[model samples]
Each structure stands twice: as C-alpha cells, then as structure tokens.
Target: MNKPDPIPARLAALKTTPTHDLKKQWRDLFDSEPPPFNRRYLESRLAYRIQELTYGGLKRETVRRLERLGEELDGGDRKKSRVRADRDRPTTGTRLLREWQGVEQVVTVTADGFEWQGRPYRSLSAIARAITGTRWNGWVFFGLKNHRRGA
Candidate 1:
C-alpha cells in the first residue's frame, strides 16, 4: 500500500480548461504577425492564456517538458515541425493564414512582417473583411515601404 502521487493531483487541479475558444482567440490574434508582435495583448484582452508558452514564447526545454506532462495527462497532440531552421524566411509575398475560429478573426501571417493590434492583419482590406465581411464598404492596402508617422 502506497500513497498516491501528489504531482498528479496538483496538475489535475491546475489544469484549467481553456474558457474562451482558442480558435477564435487565435484568429483574432492571428491578424498580427511578422514583427513587433505582442501575444500578451490577446491574453490580456481575452482574460486567459490558453497557449502554454510564455510571453517571450516557450523555451525548447519547456516545450518538451510540457509535451511530456501532457502525454502523461493523456494529452499528446503537440507536434513539432521537422523543417530545417534556415528555410524559415519569407521568400515571397505569400502570407500564411492560421485561423482560430474561437475568437472570430484571422491571423495574417508572413515569414517577414509586423504585428499591429492583437490581430495580425496583413492589410487594411483583410482587417476590413474581418470586421465587415467581404461585402462591407471599404478598401485596404499595404505599400511596399514603411511610411513615417508624420509623412
């Protein structure tokens, strides 16, 4: 006869199920990609931190630990990309959109880009479309260069 592991109990107790739909939240935050990004905005705005990583993103070791813990907890869906590290650059204008439906928004993404607001909108039109759908009244565009605030 042995005592039960307190670690399990503590983890179980700490396992707070994500309250807000991650998809929607992720979508909303997705609008802001590239650089000068702040994932914290989304977490603070939503009042929750569904993603396990930290404000500065997760360290490799932490990710592994989390994955291991998750597996032990019967949650083993965390998969790591096998692609090479050097090929992570944005070679073209192609923007990758990662949608999380829970928050009702889109994550306009690119290998080289910047984040504005919590959502990672690539262009004004995309943002407009997000807020007003395809038929809404407005237009948006991104110039090839960055303009100064006064200009």
Candidate 2:
C-alpha cells in the first residue's frame, strides 16, 4: 500500500484561494515564474500537473502503438498523407471566400478536394491561377501565409 497524494485536494480548493496565494502556489508547484493566464487556466494546469506527478506519464509502447495506428489509418505514403495535414488544407465543409477583380469568389472544402464555381479543383494553386489568370502561391493568394510589409 502507498500513501495517497494530497495535491489533488489542494488543486480542487484553488477556486477559493486568493490571487496572491495562488501565485505562491504556482511557484511552489512549478518552481518557475507563473504565466499571466487567468485563474481558471492556472487551476486547470496545476491540477493536471498534480495528477501527472502523482502517477507516471504514458509508456513508450503506448505512444508507438498510437503512432502506428495513425500511420495505418493514413495509408502510410508520405505524398498521399500530405493532403490530410492541417497546415494548408481547409477542413471538410469549410467555405473559403476570396475577392478577385471586384467579384466575390466562394470555395467550399470537400472530403476529396475543394469546389469552386460548381467545379472541383485538385489544389488551391489551380484555383488561384483560374481566378487570376496567372501563377500564384495558393496560400499567399488566399491570405493563409503571412506577407511581410515593404519586402
């Protein structure tokens, strides 16, 4: 038998603790400067820390298993898997609105590809080219990537 951790009870009681006391508690638990987040964030993170410290983290085998499952579900080809990455591709059912030559263009995200003007396109770059009649980076044209001022 092992003694139970007292940190969880203390974390639950954080709701009633004063702001100053909460700061001190944060320092004691994290041994670092407390972030400037609200009280709710502090309490939740502290509670998670307490629970993590009380028990142990996940095992290496579990992480590897999850990764293997993800690779299996994604079909395991680098080029094929790139389409599912969230960085540049919009989620399914999302609508992307753009304006070109004073006309508003709407593109809807589908499971397989994007739909624009009653037509299906393989890539946003193709859509951008069709709209502008010139080659352009799709993410830049759609304002997904940041553009620096005075380049």
Candidate 3:
C-alpha cells in the first residue's frame, strides 16, 4: 500500500490554525518576525512556507525568467523601483478621478508619474496643484493613503 500524502493534510490544517500559531510557524520556518499584516496574509504565507519546506522552491531557471520579466517593467533599475514603492505610486494605466469645485479631475498613471489635461506631471502633488491652485498632499487629495497595504 502507498503511504498517504501528508502535504494535503498539512495544508488543510493551516486554514483552521489560530493566528498566533501561524505567526509562530512563520517565525520557525522563516526565522524572522512575522510582518504586521492581516490573518489572510499570514495564512497564505505560512501555507507557501510549508509547501516550500516539503517540496523545494522554484528552480534557478524559473527564478531568472521571472526576474527578466520584472526587469521589462522595472527597467532593471532596483533603486528607482525601491523609491517608487516608498511613494506607493499606482501601477501604469491606473486612472485617478476626483471632482473639485465644479470640474471633474482626471489623472492617468504612467511609469514616470501621471498625466493630466495633456500635461505630464512628475508627481501627484503637481497635479493636485494644477487642479486646486494650492499646495496639498497629493495622495490625500487623490483619496489615497501615503502608504500601500502591507503587501
């Protein structure tokens, strides 16, 4: 008789596990403190960790291929991407719409920054300035938080 597969059982158990236990498992498996995120995030990461420990991680070729794909969008510049992440900028093709005073404002996200009224803006603050004629926190004006979700 073949031995029963334990991975499925292990994965199933994660759904019912307490958040604290999941955090501990994350610490044990990752050897680091669990990030401050919601329970869903913890469960998913823990599930991946369990599977990774059982079946080895992705092959080097797959990792390299993914990196190349990311480079196509990130321009292979780690520093610039890191800064963009800090700013919590939206991805390309995102449209931000807001109504101020009596006019509807529209901003389209681009790799460099944003475009509004056929003008390229280096920052959201610039767009906000053009719309309101006053200094404002661009993210706040655009109804977005300064930080992204704990992704």
Candidate 4:
C-alpha cells in the first residue's frame, strides 16, 4: 500500500507556527514569495494548496460545468456589456449625505437597495421622495450621475 501523505499533519502544525516560519514554509510549498494576507488567510490557503498537491485538483469536466453554469447565470454577452455600467455604481455600505431645506439627510447603500431613516428603499428615488416630499431621480439626487447637457 502507498504511504499516507504527511500534508495533513503539516497543515495542523501550521496553525501553531509563528508568522515568520509560516512564511518560510509557504515559500517552500508554493515556490514563490508569500502574499501579504493575514496569518489566518495564509494558513487556510496553504492548507488548501497542500491538499490540492496531494490529491490532484478538480477534473477538467467539473471546471467546464462550473463555467457553463456561470455563463448561464450571468447571461454571457449581456452580463459582459453590463459590467461597465455596474462598475460606475457605488458599492454596498457607502454613505451618501445631502442637505435639503437646511436639514442634512443621510442614506446608506445596501446589497439590494438603499437605506434612509432606518428604513430600506428599493431605489434612491424612493429615498429622495421620502426625504424631500417630491419626485426626483435618485442617481441625480445623490450626485451619483451627471445631469449636465452634452457639450
């Protein structure tokens, strides 16, 4: 019978090893300089790399299936075209502050929408309406999009 791999034991020991020693081990295992990630991230990725080396990586068929699923979910070409549009928008947890009628209003970006006055709104327009009692384009109201005429 083949001898059992020693990677598991080394992975367990990695947790207790000092950062400097871990960096040296990482260099040996990966044959490259260690990244600037934290100790936990380094340990976890190292453990994964050790296991992958001992028991081979995912099969080509599995990788192809994952790519197919990703393309289907993202709608392929449609998703690629929208990438630039999505990049122009603010990310979640961003805070937007605006002053209207001598009162300061604060809105926070969320994963699914925006939050204002401790309430969730599906769009910035809804939050702006609640704040100003008038209809408004949310992206323009929040200064997220330009409203100037084309030169």
Best-matching candidate per TM-score: 3
**Alpha carbon lDDT of each predicted model:** 0.41, 0.75, 0.83, 0.79
lDDT of 4 by residue, 1-151 (tens): 9997787788899889999998987898899998654566688878888888888888999999988887786665666746744565578899999998899999987776677887677678878887888999988888866633321
Better of 1 and 3 by TM-score: 3
Model 3 / residue 78 / CA error / Å: 2.6
Give one clash count per candidate, in the order shown.
19, 0, 0, 0
Candidate with top lDDT is 3
Which has the higher TM-score value, candidate number 3 or candidate number 4?
3
State the local distance difference test value for candidate 2.
Answer: 0.75
lDDT for model 1, please.
0.41
Locate the minimum summed-lDDT window of 10 residues in model 3.
Answer: 142-151
Task: Kindly list the per-residue Cα lDDT of model 2 for residues 1-151, writing each as its tens digit.
Answer: 9988677677778889887887887898799987665566677777777676777656789988987887897866667667545445667999888999899988888776777888776667778988999999876888765522312
Consecutive 10-residue window with the lowest summed lDDT within model 1: 137-146
Model 2 misses residue 125 by how many Å?
Answer: 0.5
lDDT of 1 by residue, 77-147 (tens): 43322132114323344443433344433333444342334545434444545554664322213331223
Residues 6-77 of candidate 3: C-alpha lDDT, one tens digit per residue: 998988898999889998999999999987655666778888888888998989999999999889978889
Residue pairs whose backbone atoms clash in candidate 3 = none
- RMSD to the true structure for each prediction, in A, is 15.4, 15.2, 12.8, 12.4
Task: Please report the TM-score between candidate 1 and the true structure.
Answer: 0.22
Model 4 residue runs over 4 Å out of place are: 1-4, 73-151
